[model samples]
Target chain A: MAADRVTLSDVAREAGVSLATASRAINGSADRSVRPELVERVTAAAARLRYSPDATAQAMARGRTTTLGLLVHDIADPYFSAIAAAVVASAETAGLQVSLATTQNDPAREVQLVDLMRRQRARAVVIAGGRSAGSSTEDLAGQLAALRAQGVGVAAIGQPVPGVPSVAVDNLGGSASLARALLALGYRTFALLTGPRQRTTAQERCRGFSDALGAGGGVVIARSETPFTWEGGHAGMLRLIDDGSLHGVDAVVATNDVMALGALAAARERGLRVPEDVALTGFGGISTLRDVVPALTTVAVPMGELGERAVRLALTAEGDVVESVGCDVVVRASTPDLRRR
Target chain B: MAADRVTLSDVAREAGVSLATASRAINGSADRSVRPELVERVTAAAARLRYSPDATAQAMARGRTTTLGLLVHDIADPYFSAIAAAVVASAETAGLQVSLATTQNDPAREVQLVDLMRRQRARAVVIAGGRSAGSSTEDLAGQLAALRAQGVGVAAIGQPVPGVPSVAVDNLGGSASLARALLALGYRTFALLTGPRQRTTAQERCRGFSDALGAGGGVVIARSETPFTWEGGHAGMLRLIDDGSLHGVDAVVATNDVMALGALAAARERGLRVPEDVALTGFGGISTLRDVVPALTTVAVPMGELGERAVRLALTAEGDVVESVGCDVVVRASTPDLRRR
Candidate 1:
């Protein structure tokens, strides 16, 4: 049954044309000057044989695939989903397909998926989310160079890879602004919930927030290392509550919005009034957070734009290797103005 | 620059082997009985030439691509993202890569994407969400038949296309159960916020709830047709409130969770206490919905499992055309038991 499958070569044979001529006639290469009659003959033969141009065969014949590979940290996370959606939309508009892979923040898995994308000869590989510090940058750079050597475009959203262009969110600047805003609201003592220790994004955000707080002479009463997930924030907040570490904390600042949501749930479970007993803020102004009472005061990074800009960066690559986007500190009811107190 | 790409023919010439032998060795085909030393020579030469096996060429020789195509309504929607995440995980486990596309509920775009997948030779095509009634079923059937004839697997999640295997959700049964639960809680009046009226899933769910309510002699004061989005639900609820239709309504049931969250926000904005001033419920038990205060009372659909099951059904085809999964009506703090009223 497999032997009966139609191939481009079969189409060429049926059309009584050379493989190269049939390919050029079908694919309509810019450099090829094929006769109209030959193009018509090939098209008619393909129609009669019900020959569909297999993307893989075309990729082999012409050194490019219509597909792009998108590697995200986790798709189930709304933040990444928003970006993934934008990436898919941008790819579609550019007449390209997306092959999505999830790394679950695993450095080894990220490297493996990149190799797979290379093998598949995707037009570009878009890495969404922050790169893990655990992965050796030299190895990743070498792999990327090989892809570029093959004429494949490489771009990242949030993640920074040497020699590869990226659309990066200003995490440090955004978090620093959040710290300033919170301090202005009279949150002097704080507890911070950080994602995986190895994540450079989390580290940068933590450092920026810490620096701003230090400048204001505000103490970080407690720090918790948690997964970059809601459950992590929930569990971490519960542990903080149990440990009495939040005893005098004026506010809780989570590295991401999802974790902040978990912390809010924990505070609610313990009957803590938001903005009254404790103020809470998060990074990543996710859409769903809009409906949460005392809306999450967060760093509004344009998640969708990140995906779009990443694809744009890949498709229209100039000499620029990095494009940085700014984020805003959106204050909502989640954090109250301490000046009133 | 284009001529510089190393081809299989070049690798074969360098290795002193026939092109066919090099291909078989590289593809690891079972039919060929090539000598081990020849295979080693071909592999080393290919490596020395920096020759990565072109996946497209391999697909032409092997009759299929290892990539699966997943078409969803919208990936940004949490419901779809959950399903997508599951599908990607399952495909990875099965040693398949996934190519994702979004129709944004556009039927014409769906057909166009399906054709693109056909051209790309996706191993299987999984269409998530309900099919648009506007598209001719026969036309879709013909497309599926062609895919199957080409030896590609076809499975749909929640969408029922004739002759295509599907993993369907029990939307009607679940909605009926939700109505019964609500009725038992002593709510005599209700309002419904349904997705676009043309959506079959929305129509079926609305019908089920309406039928159950009619059977109980309960009254639905109003019904609003809205987009399947949070803002839609919010605007719908506000309209219902402004029209005084919800003046005496005991509860509002949204067709999906995101919308319900919107309705919850609308009620909060109006100074209504959930379950005290009014009750609220939503369908599609999305995980993020858990963080909402007064945990949403919803029908739990294993969205991720649906995606996984669809892929499994496509992979292990045993002539079964449809697999129906049940949903549970989870009672939470959002909807108070009216029996005590």
Candidate 2:
């Protein structure tokens, strides 16, 4: 079937040129030995024959694919979806296609994807979200070096990978701000729900919040390590409630919004009201959670901008430079004003 | 710096073979002209030199990219994201990569993306949203034909384009069922907040719901065309409320979930309670909306499975086939049993 179709040789025959000369002219080779009239004649013949050069061949000669690779923890997560959307938009404006991969927070998978992107010779690669503490970063660094050796640009969003440009949210600063605001509200005792200990974002947030509360001489009544999901938060909150330790804890500090959402569901199931029965504070200002009544008091990160900035940095910036983006502490109705009381 | 790197010629020299034979062996070409011992020698030499061929050159020789192209309306929209996640998962299992593009509901952009995918020689192309009613399908048909000429596979998720295989949700059937359920609840008058008329999904959904309601001797009190977004729904609902046109309307039926979310916000702004003040129903069973109290009554479509099935159909199916996936009508607190009253 392919034999029946018009080929580049046919175009060369029609254009009355040698195969080598026709190939050089039609492929737009920078050799300059092919005359202008010959290039035009070959191009017109190829157009008349409706011939397109093999894309892979075109890419090989050009040393880069007109593609960018995006590695996200999970595209199903609203946080990551928002970032993915931004990356797509930016890539579109740059006339580049985006190939996405979900690592499921697996370090090995992330390393494998980076290697794959290197083999594809993508124009750039963006790694979104935090890295796991348990993973071997040394291997990833080696893979990244290989990509750089092949001239593929690399940038990371959220995680600070060594030798890679990055745009990370100030997780520590944001959580500390939230803690101070809660302390100002006269919430002296709190129950904390954190994500997996291996997640750097969770660890940083936990340390920041605990540090700030300790500075204020506030008490952390109880703490639980939850998965970075609603179910994890719900289960942790349930455990805390069942342990009969809810006598005087004034608030629940959830490390992330999904966990906070789960905490809300757990509290509701136990016939407790937010802010009134027990105040709640969450990290990660996800837009989906913004509509909930008694809007969650959380630190809002510019997720879309994070993706856009990462792409921009990857495509233009040089060498292992890292850029940190700030976060805002949004005090919503979930934690009411204790000053009035 | 690149000049210092080892080239394939160096490997050929180390292997003691002619350039052509070494190239064929190292690229794993099926020509079978190179001797077996010579192939092994070339392979070993290439491995020792750590030589990786330029990816583009390799792709050109192979005649296809190990990637699929996915065109969606908006990646940030949870509906598309859910499907994208599923598509990525299935593609990974199949050992294929997915390159994504967002058309932003523009017909010209969609055409451009399809052409781009064709130029890239993607394994398959999936269009995951509605085609605009305003655009001429003739141009799109031509593009699809060109893709077919190149041996590229094509499939669509929501809209049905001529000569393209598709996996579509039963929008008409699902909306009709939702209409029946609402009528059974004894809601007499209704207001509809619909997406842009250019969108086929919105059009089909509107036709189905209105047709079913009209059949039951019910009236559609007011209808407004809005953008397919929460903001659009909110503005449309606000207009309806301000017009004092919802006087006897018992419910607002939105074409999709995002609009319903907007309507919820608009109603709350007017101090109107859901179910008690005015009932609401939405199509597209979004899990994010499930967490809301007075859980949204909607038609549950298997979003993730829709994507997986579309990919499977694209890769395996022959001819212009259209498969309709069924949807289920879910009853929740948003639409109560008003028949008893």
Candidate 3:
């Protein structure tokens, strides 16, 4: 049998105060004219009864819930999880709870989640995923606009959404720098492993790396467009190896760290020693991948800082504020100094 | 400028129907006797208005929110992230959104999160963390009891809370089996790297392995207790190595996968070869760690399934259900057969 939860009415009766006075004391009335002693008595009674004010009722009365909606492509991915962790921590510091929804990399699901957040009257919504261009993107933009119009705050990480504030990472510059570093290390011919062509992240990183390599007199011998996942990277690397595309390639560059890790596994399975047989590099220096053997060389994007900045942007009532965070290239065992050798 | 959101009254006005009829048609009346034509009219009007029902209002009317609360120790950790991903996916299938809270491994924070969930009127809660015995546990028990008294479903993973259902993995059995497998491989001397002593999951694992190893005439030369993190494992391993406790230890057993990965890094940094110089083993076969060089030997617990099952148990109306999930010992290259040598 369900037991009756303690109600504010019971607290009022116990405190010997009027219902209005009890409510004002507990929920903090705008007037704030209640006597100090009365407030203390009501609070003590409420504490004694262990009464918790219903958030649903409070949201209805206040027009917004103390909840932030966080949308991610996949929570299981270390990249997304890292961002989600930062968002949750920062939201807590602001006295907000986070409702997380995974879009499962589906654009339609992302749109649906934004609508759901609007329905929940969330104080803010933070999107942490790459943008894909299509009708789904249009639908997402429309839904986000509707949410914004309802006085809900919205911000994005990784990529910009129309009319929404965003914290953008320097993916292009980071990838370009990584390529220049590799070029200096004597990698003349490279093979590229990229995500689907529609993803702006993949497109930007690929273009930056290729352009920088070209400027430095290096060449791209092969390119593979695959899903932005570990399996995709493994399959892409295997395909390149089987097709003899890596025969003369001095290095392989993946669009992201997880993909680079998958490529490393593929290389090992194929009996190739890293940096000795061929050098490797990736974007996004995820912390979880730090201990992997032949530590991956990557562009260390501040993922946690990106999430924190996105939350701050969403909570702020500023218009279209775009904050750019920079990344640094970390050279590790995966990409040894070939020039010295 | 804030725009006025569409309400049920607007839908009723557009449909030229009574407010009661609109409510019954849109939100589903208990009798289900509303005329089909009336329902169709209301639905079409609502679609035209692009009206979405406010979840707060609905929750106030129904006395419960269509939300699930998921509590994790650390979302950035692969182990918790994998479980969280499954819980979110399963909750979504049940038409519930998940509000995630990280306790930061603090018992007091866990209690506070449960209280927050109670205030939010969550339909169910799935706790994915180890239990520690103390007054904080008592406080948590009281909070969970109050939540259940108010008709909220509750279930735990990894360890059981008093009178609550749980989806428990066979940590003891899994660890014992792993120890036996190592013993069979002629690993006679070992060192143990465990998490904090208060964590029930870590205690059970350590006990299981030690007991099994003792039965097999193998001795644990060194033991270290550290935080349940990768850094903890690395530190524990370094401490043991530096103290000369591992001078002749045949292998090191880390209580979890991340710790094992950390220990592997420590070993590599010390210029020791894996399996040749010292074999290593860990519990929990986290998928993200699959590509590590000298693939780690671990007890492959179905973390995702545990999460899914916990969600299922929480959602079910049945009383106090306990589900035990099994694990398998995956022998990888990290633990070679010393008997063969």
Query: How far in Å is the alpha carbon of A50 misplaced in model 2?
Result: 3.8
Clash pairs detected, candidate 3: none
What fraction of the reference structure's interface contacts does model 3 contain? 0.83
lDDT (tens digit, per residue) of candidate 2 on A1-341: 14566777898999999987787786555334689999999999999988876555556555568899999989989899999999999988887889999999788989989988877789999989887764477678778777766677788899778888889889999988888989998889998898888889999998998999899988888889999998998999888888976669999999999888888888888988887988888887887775566678999999989989999988887888889889899999899987787
In terms of docking quality, model 1 is medium
Task: Return the lDDT, model 3, position B5.
Answer: 71
Q: On a 0 to 100 scale, what is the lDDT of residue B294 in model 1? A: 74
| Model 3 stretches astray by more than 4 angstroms | A1-3, A9-49, B1-3, B9-48
Screening candidate 2 with a backbone cut-off below 3 angstroms (N, C-alpha, C), the clashing residue pairs are A56-B60, A57-B60, A60-B56, A60-B57
Q: Sort candidate 2 into its docking category.
A: medium
Off by over 4 Å in 1: A1-16, A28-33, A44-51, A318-320, B1-7, B28-37, B44-51, B134-138, B318-320
The sequence of per-residue lDDT tens digits that candidate 1 reaches over residues A117-157 is 98787898898887666446556767876677777888878
Error of 2 at B279 (Å): 1.1
Stretches of candidate 2 exceeding 4 Å from the true structure: A1-6, A30-37, B4-6, B26-39, B53-55
Docking class of predicted structure 3 = medium
Task: For residues B130-239, write the lDDT of model 1, one tens digit per residue.
Answer: 76565555576678767777778888898577788889999899999999888888888998998889888899889999999989878888888888888989899888
Task: Write model 3 residue lDDT over A120-177, tens digit each, in one string.
Answer: 8899999998988778878887888778888888898998877788899888899999
